[model samples]
Target: MSNDPLLDELRAHEEQVWDALVRGDADLDASLLCQSFLGVYGDGFADKSAHVGQLAEGATVQSYALTDLRARALGSDHAMLSYRARFMRHRRNQAEDMYVTSIWQRTEGGWINIFSQDTAAGEATD
Candidate 1:
């Protein structure tokens, strides 16, 4: 087995999260989100259930493409991940993109996402 425990753990958790989002896995989504999670949406903040419920509703997240994914350790128990997600909204029949940042903390039950913020990649204005 490898020795870099921190890096190995972080990598594993990151993959778990990304896979969940891409596959629209409600169980994994709920499991990874902290009970006190604060998610900053396009314009406001939502609690843990409110955020995860969106995924659990099975509202057809047709294709979530992640790019420029990177993770950095923030002290001993926290990690920050940044990435851009390009996804299609099946309900609206539209394509959308956003820049996302998620902060995760190692908890007794494993890794849980404590904070998340997403900004829409809007069209440039001249």
Candidate 2:
């Protein structure tokens, strides 16, 4: 695995987003996701505006965190972050944990999440 500080740096960015989500800070979330951000989830797909729009429209995320983080640099200007994300949404019956991979591209300002896909981790066999 690549032991680059970029991993931690991006991880911190991801945490910042989690904080923003829980707080329903759409501006913060907007700053982190790219203009063309695309999120692929179980229900459907969402674009950048639509993604943050939820928070802007009063959607609430109770809490969230990422674990087992691993990042791979895609050339010099991009990286892929893989981890297990656990989070709870407001009014939801229960929390959900999913395996997630987010693609971030480094730009003049900084890194912005450009794409993300979530895969549900089914019940443990053991």
Candidate 3:
């Protein structure tokens, strides 16, 4: 845990998203996202429904770990969280790493993820 409470809180929320993916809990995943949630991934873009729809068949991720967390408040009601995620897909032998940035906003119901982007970590250019 870090000294910043906002970072900790956002980290917890981010973990919940990974947990939902592992458990194939579409409802939980949907609940965490705002109705207008937007995700930019290497494949393309995904809205809230498309994000939760990935688990329709079952869990897609076997395991995951988050590190190098950083968070910044985007005012009082919104925050941006960035981290490195190492994870393996279900039934896959290899793991993949990606850098993720997520934006969350405070709402009457609680905090809801409003936006996110994932970038694959490729071999070092240098």
The models' CA-based lDDT, in order, is 0.76, 0.88, 0.96
State which candidate, 1 or 3, has the greater TM-score: 3
Instruction: Mark the regions of model 2 whose C-alpha exceeds 4 Å error after superposition.
Output: 1-3
Clash pairs, candidate 3, are: none
Give the top-scoring candidate (TM-score).
Answer: 3
Tens-digit per-residue lDDT, 57-94, candidate 1: 56456566767777788988898878787888656678
Clashing pairs in 2: none
Give me the displacement of residue 94 in model 3, in angstroms.
Answer: 0.5
Worst 10 residues of 2 by lDDT: 56-65
Candidate 3 residue-wise lDDT, 1-126, digit = tens: 889999999999999999999999999999999999999999999999999999999899999999999999999999999999999998899999999999999989889999999999987786
Per-model TM-score on C-alpha atoms: 0.76, 0.91, 0.97
Q: Return whichever of 1 and 2 wins on TM-score.
A: 2
Q: For candidate 1, what is the lDDT?
A: 0.76
